[model samples]
Target: MLTLAETPPGAVVRVIEIMGGRGMRLRLMRMGLNLGDLVKVLSSGPLRGPVYLENLSTGVKLALGRGVASKVLVEPQ
Candidate 1:
């Protein structure tokens, strides 16, 4: 498994796990980032601070902070 933030841009990843408590988990869920969902990395910088992701299920675009994105584990497909 690899972190979403560490994945290369344009790669499709399946959300495998989320590491956080109830509040944080719920917040991420509301943003359409749920387990088993597939997301594509849209863009990233050199250090991977902020990344743009597109939720395949909802077709929603979200910019996630590196710290939060790092907690999301995914498998490339």
Candidate 2:
């Protein structure tokens, strides 16, 4: 499983797992990211900044901090 933080811009990946605690899981869920969702990496922010992505399932775009993104496990799709 590759973390979302490791994924490069322009890649499409499937959410495989979220390696975080329950609170983190709830936060991500409210942000519209969930297991099995397809997401496209839009911009991998610079200098350990946030990662911007688009949820292919809902056409929603959001930004996630590097730490939070690293907890999201994904597979290239």
Candidate 3:
């Protein structure tokens, strides 16, 4: 498993866990990210900026801050 931030661009991965407080988890959930969901790494901004991701199940694309991405654990699919 690896953090979402470490996932390579275009890689499809499954979300395993989100390591943060309840508010953080709820925020991600509201964005369509949840445990066991498949997420694709779309693109990463330069200079440690936001990382773009696509939720395979919902077809939603979102940008996550580096810090948040680092807390999202994923396994390559």
Stretches of candidate 3 above 4 Å error? Answer: none
lDDT by residue (3-71, candidate 3, tens digit) is 999988999999999999999999999988999999999998887989999999889899999999999
Highest lDDT: give the candidate number. Answer: 2
- Residue 10 in model 2: lDDT: 99
* Displacement of the residue 16 alpha carbon in candidate 3, Å: 0.3
Over 1-77, each residue of candidate 1 has an lDDT whose tens digit, in order, gives 89987999999999999988888789999988899998999997667479899999789899899989989999998
Residue 73 accuracy (lDDT) in model 2: 94
Q: How accurate is candidate 1 locally (lDDT)?
A: 0.90
Question: What's the C-alpha lDDT at position 41 in model 2?
Answer: 98
Candidate 1 wrong stretches, greater than 4 Å: none
Judged by TM-score relative to the true structure, which candidate is superior, 1 or 2?
Answer: 2
Which window of ten consecutive residues has the lowest lDDT sum in model 1?
Answer: 43-52
Ranking of all predicted structures according to TM-score, beginning with the best and ending with the worst: 2, 3, 1
lDDT digits (tens) for residues 7-47 of candidate 2: 99999999999998999999998999988999999999898
Lowest-sum lDDT 10-residue window in model 2: 26-35
Off by over 4 Å in 2: none
Best by TM-score: 2
